[model samples]
Target chain A: MNLYDIATKLDASILTPKLDLSRQVHCAYGADLLSDVLAFTRPSTLLLTGLINIQVVRTAEMAELGGIVVVRGKPVHRSLQELACACKIPLLRTRMTMFESCGRLYQSGIKPCIKDPGCECNVCPSV
Target chain B: MSAPLCKKEFFVQEFDFEHAGKAASDMRKLLMDYGFDQQIVRRLAIAAYEAEMNMVIHGFGGTLIMEINFEYIELVAKDNGPGISDLKLAMQEGFSTASDEIREIGFGAGMGLPNIKRCVNFLGIETKPGQGTVVTMRVDLGPDAI
Candidate 1:
């Protein structure tokens, strides 16, 4: 789904510049653990989490995640937003809890990206 | 252009959770500029970030020294804090000593050291209780390795 569609579905607000909402989100990962997310998420997967910290942005950048959706109406701190902007990763906020957001996205046909064969260990997959 | 060999140092403050990943991010950029392959750079970045996180959350404070050469990139993180008493337990996938506060920040999942080991070619750890710990990680950058 596109960014616009995701924002509308989750009732999320864009915290970064309105760039090409046309970016394709092939998969979604809903987790607050940056390490798990880093270990699991494939490049370009949208990240859904309740954590609102600078490390989130840093993890997104390192993993080359497509975008980040903060759940439970969690506010994205300004510094994080700035980092997101600097990294060109979209940041959004939603009042919906993580479970609801994941369910909604799954119901909408977004699936988890295929895990890298190298990541078949105990690490959580980005699905 | 031929790849550039370089070394840089980063000082991580004790419990400075706010800026933990900055050093790794900077190092990643430097590796990119040195013309390292994207996959190599990404692996190095992940390893470096994990090491940096350990410094902030577990080591109390430390220095991360990174050296990038043509064949490999090496990260040496040294810290002065209560050291890891049981290396075997610490290397376990689900063993963590991080406080509740660190867990709340979405870390302390016990994957930091393991992930670093998984992403790099060589991983070494040295620790003395009440003194500190030093972790050395190397990522091979040759074509076959990538």
Candidate 2:
């Protein structure tokens, strides 16, 4: 799905500055731990988390994540938004909880970016 | 090792979660300025940030000393605090001693040591209870390693 579809589906606001909504989002990761996300996530995956801090932006930059979806209707700070703008990472706010957001994306054909071929997540069909 | 091409020292205040990743970010910039490869730079940045956050979350105020060479980069984090008793367990993926408050800030998922190990070519940890912990990590940029 594209950013526009996700925003429309979840009633999310495009918090990043001047993003192209047509960018395709292939997979999504739902986690609050930046370290875990950095360790496991692949590039261009949309990150869904409840953690509202500056490190979210930094983690997205380090992992080369496509965008950030803040769950639970939390308001992102201006500093984080500015950093997202500077990093060219699209940031969005969603009223849906993390589980709900993940479920919606999964039902919409988005999967997790699993690097390991032997992993057994249903969305990740054996790499 | 010889003298580093560039060496930077940072003092990380104890229990300061807000400014934990600054040193790592600075190191990333330095590596990029030195024309390091993007993969190497990313690995070093991730490893450095994990180590730096560990120091902040677990150790007391400490020093992050970075040495960048033409062929590789080395990050040495030394802190004086209550040290880890079980190095093996500490290296586990889901083992964390970070408090609830730290968890709320999007860390303490018990991936620090494992993530650092994953991102570096070589990682060494030395800790003695009540003394300190010294984590030395190196990422080589040679043709054979990459």
What digit string (tens of lDDT, one per residue) describes model 2 on residues A1-127?
Answer: 8888988878898887487768888988899888878877776789999988988888887767789999999978898898888767899999999989999889988888676666542212133
- DockQ score for model 1, please? 0.57
Per TM-score, the best of the predicted structures is: 1
Computed on alpha carbons, the lDDT of every model, listed in order, comes to 0.85, 0.82
